[model samples]
Target: MVFTKKKIWFSSVALFILVYSINFMGYRDYFPLFLLPVLGILMIRSKLSKWFLITQIVLLAFLVCYCLMALYYGYFSFFAILGRLIYPSMFMLIGYYVAGFDTPKNLKSFSILILLITGSTLYGMFSLIKTINLYGSYENVMSALGGRLIEDLWGNSYISATVLNSSVSLGLSLLGLLFIKSNDLAPNKRILKIAILSIFLASIYTSATLGNRTGIITVIVSFFTIFLLKLNSNIKGIIRLIVFIISLYILKLLFFNLNTFGVRSYWESSFIFSRFENSKVYDDPRYEAWTTIIRNFNENLLGGRQINLSVNFAHNLWLDVFYDAGIFPLIFLVIFTIISLISLFKLLKLELPNIYKGLVIGLYTAFFLTFAVEPILQGFVVYFTFFCFLIGIIQRKLTSATY
Candidate 1:
């Protein structure tokens, strides 16, 4: 089969969707292995922009420096370093194609992909319902099913049915809502638009049910940021905003009234005063992890210590960078993040469509929030790749003389 540009593009998008959507299951841990061939294909066929290439080179150089230092320290493991590099490297490749190829079409495809993900998550929620019905409690259901479950400070169980996948779904739903709001649909297309909106609402509810504070906060922040930024100026925007608020209120009431499987009460409790009062204790582990990493820092602050440490990551991106690769790499990562934010802000200032701006904001907010709770650049492959893709898109737009 002839692999034309269009074919390659579609194939890449399909692979992305497959990897991203199936993450609701437990298979995402091996996604990097499956993504290897796709990355190779993308590297060979995709066109790269100058800035994107430069960014990759800098990251590659840093990785090489870090690896050599680890080797000298007798902690070098080829596969270990390779595993760490896979997602970010793949992200660069994703960004390359996303920037140089058909962007608008790819964006549309991504919108559809997210809708599919929302549907899959809803299915998972329903499955959880079934499990609860059978087992009489979330804990009993998880015990029977046997998977990771996180309990919040209140002893309320939160299922990792979708794990980190909820973060991506939340970002997508925000972007999808913005897209739907900004676009004018034909009478025939209104149903489809409504369906997408309903799915977005459901995705938010599911994120809340999953009990990932970061994911829930990301969705809320992204929605309001996009809403205030794009919709505050117009009367129609205000009406839409009111409608959105009412819809959310109604959804919350429905969930509260139904109170199925204790999910509603658990979610509601997450927002109550006691949750905030006990937040410091709830965040104690993360704080202790950071303290441990800092206390264990070796003398070589430039090249970092060996990767053989028992506690590998710090859970926070900045602290993790410092712990894993030392102060130099930490500085580099911070600079990169600052530059990405500046670029995104510049892109937002451009006279682009409201939908495009909203998409950028959604991606930016999600990535930023993830850094606080997840070592996204280190382990969360989907989100890391998505962040890099958004960066690539922003870079492409900023550098293009036409825009």
Candidate 2:
């Protein structure tokens, strides 16, 4: 029995490392993505705890409701909810990985993750450059050719806001450099961190698209939060936070009007707010979405009616959930989020470096804002899986009296 558990443990770890190495290369499709969960479950005895089982059943109930709605509406053919399950089903295996292993040092783990990001970005940039040289601007680039080229070369969408959000938030490499500088690690480690951050920053700017500015600004805020959080909670620390907030206020004064402000976007004419004074169309899509959830409350309480409501994406995740599931899912979501945050915050008693705390806190902070406008439920599995595992890591550390 002991030998068997040992083999499962080691094999599962090996599988995780192998799958993680493939990283961006195999992220987009089922075979590679599904590999993790399948291996994870096989190694772990094919049984999750009753807690997870019950949770799955709950989600299953939601699924049945959705399927019934789909059958009623005649849109259940593609097996969408079932198909989408393919993504999380893969990561659920990873959750078992977290359940078993301790969190390794932040340095190597995050370095591997960021390295994949930097590599993918470079691949995308090179592809873009080649396409431009061969076919010129977007006007000349054919969608079929461009898509084939994007998938073949980069594996995922380069300009996706959620993808860019992770790379750009606190600058993956930049925070890595801060880790090196703060920690008394060897000189080579320090240099590696700095070098990685430099490449990451350049790539983020190159990948800039519509909402890039707000994302960059959020990164700055989160980065500053990290630096300040590191300072002892003395008068000096409070002053630093104060200064940071003021700077953010100024930035908001300048730009928040353009993109979304808590699930709402101002008219594109924010610069000329005066010109559109009377055109009060506060009716953002979120309101309509919210109404949908409210209306469906009696029939579909646990989540939305599992029908094929979204042909593609909700475009806005927060509003979509609120609309589909009513006010309760948001409440459940917020509570679960608070649990994650509070758990991590207590783990901070371990006094993790400002760099790591900043990295975790900043990324969560950035995602909090980003998800307001986009559903990252479909983003780099690397991001979602890594974060989930980190939570498990922190919980384990706290429980083991590591502090």
Candidate 3:
């Protein structure tokens, strides 16, 4: 195949996603930086969207101003803060560069994303089992896996993983299932879906092992949303639903029933289960952060205060926008997000393949769940950039069809 501009764009973006998804040795953190030269070239060649350009300009302005304020106040070093902001600020560019094309048209187009989802999931499972073997107790395992002490809004302390946020990666991985067809992976599509579903099921176990409820819930939401959106009253759909639920249950049983080497009891006693077992699940600290930020919005209307001093971030995407760059950028982002979501819903109704539609639905819900509580725009740059790139494709398709 000739490496046309479109192909180059797809390959680079796909490779970026794959590298970040696998996250081997923390390369995920810096891979985007390394891709700057290539992406910059593509950006120059691509016809940028007006909406994207305006939004990027406004966001960049706010970021510069915010960093200046942080610097003057001795909150942090100016260069360090600005350097960190660089990757996140590239989201608009990522979106605009790929907006001219459709979503990947063939399996080859989606291969890297597939490898990302399946490979990361398998790696997560392996990490969980390895942790178990290395540390016999739940507490020991969690601490060994880079967990740190965190207190909830209610002052309940538990160990939460600090090094890696597995939920986002896993949630993003679930989107790969959207590209799969019944006939693609196995003897039939049904078995293929089930096989991938099984990998994700074990990922739930991995989440539980790490005491990551968000990861667990996001996986369930992804599965449920994709199926629910595709649900019709037809008999075949009903049968698939039944089989899906049954398969999920059976998969769950198989994972937990592994009695060899006391793994079953080990899983049962893990921090995730123990939290629920003791009814200590409602320990959210986001409420406090949200309230404080909202109340202080007037104080920081022109420029945000240093959020790192309090909760590292506002803990909500919109609130983080409000808290980090003030109301102007917040308003722009909110309007942009609303429009993007409308585009997503519109894309779902179009005459695309079920795989693409499911990808749209699954990724939207999964990311929404994460974006609501976590500071995705600033904190999860790689995932946010990929999301922007995908949404850009949606916007592009919608615009092209209007003509």
Q: What is the TM-score of each candidate against the true structure?
A: 0.68, 0.61, 0.71
TM-score of 2: 0.61
Clashes of each: 0, 5, 3
Q: Which wins on TM-score, candidate 1 or candidate 2?
A: 1
In terms of lDDT, the poorest run of 10 residues in model 2 is 147-156
Q: Give the best candidate by lDDT.
A: 3
Q: For candidate 3, what is the lDDT? A: 0.59
Model 2 Cα lDDT, one tens digit per residue, 192-259: 66666675565555444222444545655556656656665798768866986798787776666444
Off by over 4 Å in 2: 1-27, 31-83, 86-108, 112-180, 184-187, 207-211, 238-314, 322-335, 378-386, 401-403
How many clashing residue pairs are found in candidate 2? 5
What ranges in model 3 sit over 4 Å off? 1-13, 49-84, 89-112, 115-138, 143-163, 166-169, 172-195, 232-268, 277-283, 295-297, 300-313, 377-379, 399-403
Q: Best to worst by TM-score, what's the order?
A: 3, 1, 2
Per-residue lDDT, model 1, residue 90, is 65
> Which prediction has the highest TM-score against the true structure?
3
Clashes of 3: 3
Rank order by lDDT, top first?
3, 1, 2
lDDT of 3 by residue, 1-403 (tens): 6889768867777666565655655455566677678668867876666755655565566556655555555555554565545755564465544445444344332244344555556545554455555567547754654553322112222323422344334444364464345442234566556655675676666665567656767766777777766664678878888997898778767766656567688768667766556654244567677877776667877555644334677667778767766777667667667766877877776666566566667767766766777776455545555556556556555555442
Report the C-alpha lDDT of model 1 over 275-302, residue by residue, as the tens digit.
3456764465666676666775665375
